[model samples]
Target: MKSPGIVIVGAGQSAAVAAHALREHGYRGHIAMLGREWHKPYERPPLSKAVLVAAQEPLLDVLAEEAWARSNIELLNGSDVAALDLAQQEVRLANGQTIEYEKCLVATGGEARTLLCCPPYRRRVHYIRTLDDARRLRAALQRRPQVAILGGGFLGLEIAHAALAVGASVTVLERATSLLDRFLPPEVSAWLQSNLCRAGARVLLGTSVSDAFPVETGRMLLATDAGARLEVDEVVVAIGLSPNDALARNAGLEIGPGGGVLVDANCRTSNEHVFACGDCASQQRPGQSQPTRLESWQNANEQARTAAAAMLGASPPKPPVPWFWTDQGAHNIQMLGLPADDLEYVRRGDPTNAKALWIGHRRLVPIHAVAINAGSELRALRPLFDRDQPVQLQDFHLDTLNLRAWAKQQALADAAVPR
Candidate 1:
């Protein structure tokens, strides 16, 4: 019998990883990757950081042409999957084409959410969601312009960091009382706000843009709800994202309350043959009744691998601990495990020193150690999340042989040995 063919939608990291994993597992069937963007599957995390700083050449391409060709995966770039004919087991493309497949993976990611307070004001604002958006924003920053960011979330802060690095003045206006208010606690937000301000970016809290209009050359007039009018060169909106679940909804697939395609632990949608992952799919965690939809790169890659394994008739892969990292100015911030609002937080190191550990449910769930460059410390905390026992907090102190260092050393040694 011939191997079943698979069709993967959306040419981002998740879709690419899924296709790669399927082939690696000895799936000899035909594989096709459909992407809306003209470019092949590429990495996005660096678009805001390295790509912005690198010279003319684009740094977002995750898989080179040679690699894709060698993998024997067909790439359909600059094409959209309009509809899924579940009954016929086929996918309809935007260019009036259809492909038959035994199974399909929907990795369509979300689009940036723009504030709709006023239609006219929306035209003057820009959003950072794709490589093209980053390129445009990077060009604007090169002129050493004054930029206004809409939301004080991670995206806004990261953009601000990039802008500052390129010598552009920035003012971040957040409607919430604190930056990252939804994810990080109040204290952490305060620390982040201080760092942003110290880096020369103005941080505005509890403020909303009332109106925005283009003025003189490289200038814009912005009216705020706080009865303040400000002038800036450019405006970048980083409010949030809305999942791309319209196709799923049109196909009569189950969707979450927030419009995300609902999927089971195996990454299978309501229709068993149709699967979903990445930002668009809402899959519940082990013990949580509510579904979780993460917009991080880690979640996308891991979920794709899981979907690939399940599609190949392999047992479900173990879920990796959810980890997220953000680069702001010179500080490298990382969080491991899901932090709860009710959990007690203890500072292992001085926040002024930019190093600390967070204890949750009597377990050291989050290790936040930041310095001029602390990528090593961030990598050290990844395995601690998977440990069966709670990591002692006292070991985090630099002076004493700390628990974090000892635990990390042991982990490194264990990883070095062959299984």
Candidate 2:
């Protein structure tokens, strides 16, 4: 096999995006994406929702087989990289094959965090991090068994809703005092808790599984810290993920405090020819004290483009505002900007009954915003965060709020002026 011009270490979303971006930017040389998974690259978002509920597997392919061939991109699935020979500028696979590269991108992403207590009871406990994991969990859910979801984050909640759709009773256990407390404001957190309750999910905040034992009916008995005993047929753990940075770390590349491969604004790692992106990358953006690792789809795609541009020695566009969305039953929650606990929140309309918008700001200058079932309006108000503009409280009122109309006028006004 010919040596690849750009060797991408992981064949996940970031790897697919980077390979395509390199081609788009006119880097005509050979490109290869190496992944540990047997399947082609696909998105991970639908694993908990669509994959769990639907009989037909969702077509979430990032780079289809035909597309890869058409783009002249080689996809080496089920190829595990043992170590990186930085000095030799080569990626060594576990099978003793070495692939030389002009540039290397480490997009290994992350692995799901598992509990030490549940490893012994693998048959009853499940964790979703890959397509195969989702398929296995989905088959388990088809039995409509009582499910206990550990953690109240996006993945856990989505799984709860999916289980409910399949006639399964779900109980969500979160260790925090409130659901999504780390990323959301207190009031918003309360609002989400209420929604979960209304959707038939029994949410237990500040509770965690203390011990688990097999019961007579072949179900697991869970003892909670709150001194409550619960029996469930299946347990799904959605705690979080640990970055897959062992390859970079073993190669002596710098790692960030968040346990990710450290990369600069251009996604360039310690070695100029080596780059990192996606969930595995801890990025040092412009004007930030500490490096942060964002585990979102948008971040993965954006960083892929940035790294591709850097590979070709071209100027990359500025990173967009951090954004993420989660679909929980009837509600679609979208959050903009980096999460900050210090921001004061201003509410618009009722969050439980009707759609609502929570603007989190410091001294009235918008820093972050959360839209509950109001994505388009949130997009209209997105430009506000880019500029240092102070928003008046009165503008958020349902009777007066017309951000879309206001944004349209601004667009028309800007278009009328001569360049």
Candidate 1: list runs displaced more than 4 Å: 1-4, 56-58, 64-66, 117-124, 216-218, 362-375, 378-384, 387-398, 405-419
Supply the TM-score for candidate 1.
0.88
Best candidate according to TM-score: 2
Worst ten-residue run, lDDT, model 2? 410-419
> Taking the tens digit of each residue's C-alpha lDDT, what string does model 2 give over 1-419?
45769899999999998998898889999888899999888999889889988879889988776766667878899999999989999999999999999999999999989877676237878899999889888888889899999989988999998889888899999998889888888877888888778878899888988887778899988899879999999999999999999999999999998799999999999999999999999987533569989999999999999999999999987889889999888689999887676788887767756588888877666678898898887798677667645555555666575777764444334333222
Highest lDDT model number: 2
Off by over 4 Å in 2: 1-4, 64-66, 286-288, 405-419
Record all residue pairs in model 2 with backbone atoms less than 3 Å apart, i.e. clashing. Answer: none
- Per-candidate TM-score against the hidden true structure: 0.88, 0.94
lDDT of 1 by residue, 1-419 (tens): 12259998898989988888887788888998889988778888777676666567454555567656666888888879999888988888888898888999999999989766433234346787788777777888888888898889888888888888889899999998878766665567788999899999999899999887767664678899988988888888888899988888899999976678999888999998989999999988753458878889889988998899888789768988777788876777776666555555544456677765544433443322222234455456667556544454554555565555676765445343222
TM-score of predicted model 2?
0.94
> Which 10 successive residues of model 1 have the least lDDT summed?
364-373
